[model samples]
Target chain A: MIELQHVTKVYPSSPRPALDDVSMQIDKGEFVFLIGSSGSGKSTFLRLLLKEDSPTKGVIKVNDKTLNTMSKWQVPKLRRTMGCVFQDFRLLTNKTVAENVAFALEVINKPQRTIKRVVPEVLEMVGLDGKENRLPGELSGGEQQRVAIARAFVNRPLVLLADEPTGNLDPETSQDIMLLLERINRTGTTVVMATHDYHIVDSMRRRVIELNDGILSRDQSRGVYGLGR
Target chain B: MRVNFVLSEVAAGLRRNLTMTVAMILTTGISLGLMGTGLLIANMIGDMREIYYDKIQVSIYLADGITDPQRDAIAAQLDSSPEVKDYLYESKADAYARFTQQFQEQPALIANTPQDALPESFRVELVNPQRYPVIAEQFPNGQNGVDEVRDEGDFLDRLFSLLNGARNATIAVAVVQALAALLLISNTIQLAAFNRRNETNIMRLVGASRWYTQLPFILEAALAGLIGALLAIGGLVLTKILFVDKTLAGPIKAGIIPPVDWSAIAAISPVIAAAGVGLAAVAAYVTLRLYVRL
Candidate 1:
């Protein structure tokens, strides 16, 4: 679960707050789409959730732990319970697909035996089974995204935060990634995705929270991306 | 954390930054080599001081044409003095014979020296060598049977001072080289971190702690330092064998200067290794804290 109450983020030397007086709640195992245009506080929202940036004046509770009050040494522990995916697919270019997925578990100090076993299973789940030895540079964009997804899911984190996971993919590949994400959400891991993909947002009927000019404009159950301010 | 995994990462990092790694190692080796040389010089100075200072003697030269009774009176005065630990009276003939024996290798010099040229004196060893002034005052110049009182300890003082200056100079240069080595280590670590920025970014994103991300880089520096220390020790051994032992063979054989032995090198090897590893690791750690985020 994630909760943000009266959250406002202001960047120094900027005239306005990035996220102004924002409040939201998402329960366990819900797939929430955060729809916003560029510079509409979507990235700032995700960064606040990840504790990468502190809220200027707000309280953020993730999994019942108040993030604003947490010490720096506890940040890594908080992050270990969550997974993150990026727009660029953020795979290590030099590592093989399997190694890339295993890297997630390795960082969490997983045993070698568990990494050896789970890496293949996650690769299989993401449909990257046969490309285990291929580097990210050698893989297609869609396949690379799958590797990134596999890496994110390898630890079975309680929450998954994706920032434009399919931003660089074609429409067809983007649909496939959405389906994969939907399947992952069904397995009881809460998923929060920030995106500007109108077509994908319109097709995937889910709980949508729309942001416009640093304000929450709409929160709808079973929503679609509407063309409205 | 698995040490094997960390070690593998360290190996990969070093391999990627091979040129920088080599540069760091050579700089560290040279620096530690100079440091070890300085330490060995200090030890050599200590040995030389013990060798020379223990044998220091003061000579009370009798004036020419002195009577036997005056000489006997001076000898009686020396016998009663507590400052004289022991005295050997060398007559002119005995002094000349000893001089000839010393210059036996130079036949021309030995042949030109006459029998009465050398002085007859009391070669007096003091109970405490530093009490030369007491002996000088007891047998003053222009006194009965006294010409001059010469203390070998004064010349030893000047000699040791020169050796101390050389030792201090070597240590000073070593300190400068050590500073250069530290800077090189810092730069090399920064470069290595920059090269592996992508990997480190992913590691940080994947729940790796800051220390976990830094471990491999630190290990790489430490390994380079370890290799550098070994090389420095080897350099010291080679110098002892090829330079000191060979060049100073005659003096060492004659016991004029102490030979730099294996025990002295053994004593300093650990200190050099510790300095190498400690300095390199500290430099890398500080660079990471200040420059690289991780």
Candidate 2:
């Protein structure tokens, strides 16, 4: 489902490369957790996965297409296969929860019939049925994050790339979101989650890929977060 | 589905920026109004031109001291000229009789004038008003047995040109004002778009087509222009009734500018409306192309 061949990234005006010679892969339906410290290049990796930015050196193959070779115009088509959740939720404040999710479909020029049917179903999945009409500001932190998640998954993409889904949530709420991610994973969709929350990482015992200073330190199936400790 | 969703989003956007929408309306109103006034003035002057131009008469006054052959030669010249429409030669006797008819109440005063002492002149009408100069050019310094040739059109020509120039200047000033309004409208729309940069960026990320994002903004700009034009038209009508015909024309009755003609006002209203709406939409679209394109 995803492959990065020694991908290296250096943002303009930066002294050092963000992702230094990183190469990795995860099969279809695999749930992968990228655990790292504050500046482990986790977000950069996810950005490359979604084709928001390209690798300075090396190739990124997502959904069987070489991202480097694709023209600027083709980037959106590639992004259609993946859902993205930011740490801030990045939901349009002016739009209601339903409209926010519906926007994902709308941008793709989805028909009214599809919008009517799909929006409600996704809102239900995010446990935001009655709250659909409410704006993002009216929602709680967890609920807003849930709406963001719903917007990502509404399109039924092949991969869900979440930078930090549970970053702002309390422990109890974070676990519920993890459970939701797990539920989504069971539906035969690839899930790549990057998080600094070691407690959930250690407790879930999912496949883990560790990166330290832009280099992959370890890769384990049934991996543990506090492996060194 | 795509259209409905975009439209709903645009509606939501417009509602979100209610104050902005009203501002646009005001801006459009000002610009369109100026344009309308300029057009009305130009059209009114045009109508005055048509009316006065049709009745323009050319006077071929006879020489003060002339013989019968000279008079007959002048009559023959009038018949030969292509510009001549219909000529009436009022002889001294005929002139005397007509003068007496004009002041018939003063019978004793009319009795003192002799018929042969009266001035005989040929009242010449032209085929077209434009040909007055053509005939005048032919009879320079009374060359064709005519002692003095006066068309009465030279004064009218100078007056028409002066009025036309003034009206044209008003239109030019109005165009400049309209341009400024268009710029303001463009700036306002740009500000509206700038305020919603995050919304637009998100739409881009979500694969929104260029049209889906731009349609609402373009429409909003056009709406502003339309509002401005309507206000201008209304103000113009009020000004025409209250000021143009009522006050200004009354004060200027002794001068060159005439009373306001309703038909001229009616002629160019659509042009004003179209200019308003078109300018507004164009302003929005031009700004969007520069600022909104991803």
Candidate 3:
């Protein structure tokens, strides 16, 4: 579950607020699409949820824990409950696919047995079971993104955030990635995806929250991307 | 398992930035070596000061043509003087014997010296060695069979000051080199952090604590520092063996300078090592805090 109460974020270098007077609550296990144009506070919303940056004026609560007053030391614990997938599929290039997924567990100080058991399972779930030893650079764009997803999901975080997960993938590969995300959402992990892909959004018909010029424009149950533009 | 992972990360970081690591290690090693040299010189100066200060004396040499009465009067005057704690009358034969024994390593100098060529003098030790002027005034030269009144304390002062200057110069240079070494370490850590920003970002994203992301960089600098310290110790050992023990053997054997024994080097090695490791690790930690997010 995620909740934002009148969250307004204004970066010092920029004149306008990135997110202005935004109020929203996402229930547990919901698949939500955050629809917005560029610079419409989509990434800022995700960053706020991740606690990477704090809102200039607002409160954000993820999984019943208020993030506004969260101490610096507790940010890592907060991140442990959430998974983040980026457009670039930021895998360690020098590491193998298995090591990349295992790295998430390793950083969290998981036991060797757990890492060994969970890494391959997650890689297999992301459809890279046989490519454990391959480097990220050697993989295709879709395969690399799968590796990223495997890494994010390896810890079994409660919430998964995908920021333009299919931004670099072709249409067919993008649909496959969406199917994979939908599969993940079905396992009771709340998924919040931020994107500009209208075809994927219209076809999926999930809950859509649209942002326009840093303001909440529409919140529709099972909405399409271009409805309010 | 976590320990192995962290250690592997440290190893990979060091390997990835091999040239920077090598540069940092060499800088640290050279600086720590100079520091060790400075410490050794300080220890040697301390030993030499103790040896020379304990036996410092003023010598009033007699005129060659002086009578027995003149020599006896000079000796009696030295004995009765309040400034003189003790005095020894070294006859011509005694002076010649001491000179020959001191230069025994150079037999040519002793072979050319005649027994009567050395001066007969009274070597006077004062209670307060700084009161050399008082003794000198009491035994004015050219008056009471005293040809020259020389205060060994004066020569010792000049000599110790020269050695102190050398020690100070070496330490100053060492301090400068240490600053350069610290800067190099800071820059190297920053560069290493920059190069691995993507990995660290992912690590942070996946619930890796900031310390977990940073430990590898700190450990990399510390490992380089540790190796640098070992190299410095080796340099010091080599210098002692090659330069101090071998090249300066004559001075040490002749008692002109005290020998730099193994214990002195062994005593200061831990300090050098701690300095190398502590400075580098601290530099890296501080650089991470100030410049790099991780």
Candidate with the greatest TM-score versus the true structure: 3
Return the top candidate by lDDT. Answer: 3
Q: For all candidates, what are the clash counts?
A: 0, 4, 0
Docking class of 1: medium
Against the true structure, what is every candidate's RMSD? 3.0, 6.2, 2.2
2 or 3, greater by lDDT: 3
lDDT for A51 (candidate 2): 70
> Over the stretch B39-150, how does candidate 1's per-residue lDDT look in tens digits?
9999998998888776657988988877999999988988999888888899999988877765655679878888898889988889988888999998898788788999
Per-model TM-score (chain A alone): 0.98, 0.96, 0.98
Task: Score residue A197 of candidate 2 by CA lDDT.
Answer: 87
CAPRI category for model 2: acceptable
Candidate 1 TM-score to native: 0.90
Model 2 misses residue A13 by how many Å? Answer: 4.6
Q: For residues B235-280, what per-residue lDDT tens digits would candidate 3 score against the true structure?
A: 9999988899888887788777999989999999999999998998
TM-score for all predictions? 0.90, 0.74, 0.94
Candidate 1: segments with Cα more than 4 A from true spot: A8-16, A211-221, A226-229, B62-72, B82-131
Off by over 4 Å in 2: A1-27, A34-79, A92-100, A106-116, A127-139, A202-229, B1-20, B41-71, B81-161, B194-202, B243-267
How large is the interface RMSD of each prediction? 1.2, 2.4, 1.4
| True C-alpha contacts between chains kept, each model in order | 0.54, 0.39, 0.85
lDDT, candidates in the order shown? 0.89, 0.78, 0.91
lDDT of 2 by residue, B128-195 (tens): 86677777776665554566667667777797788778777776777777776777777777777876
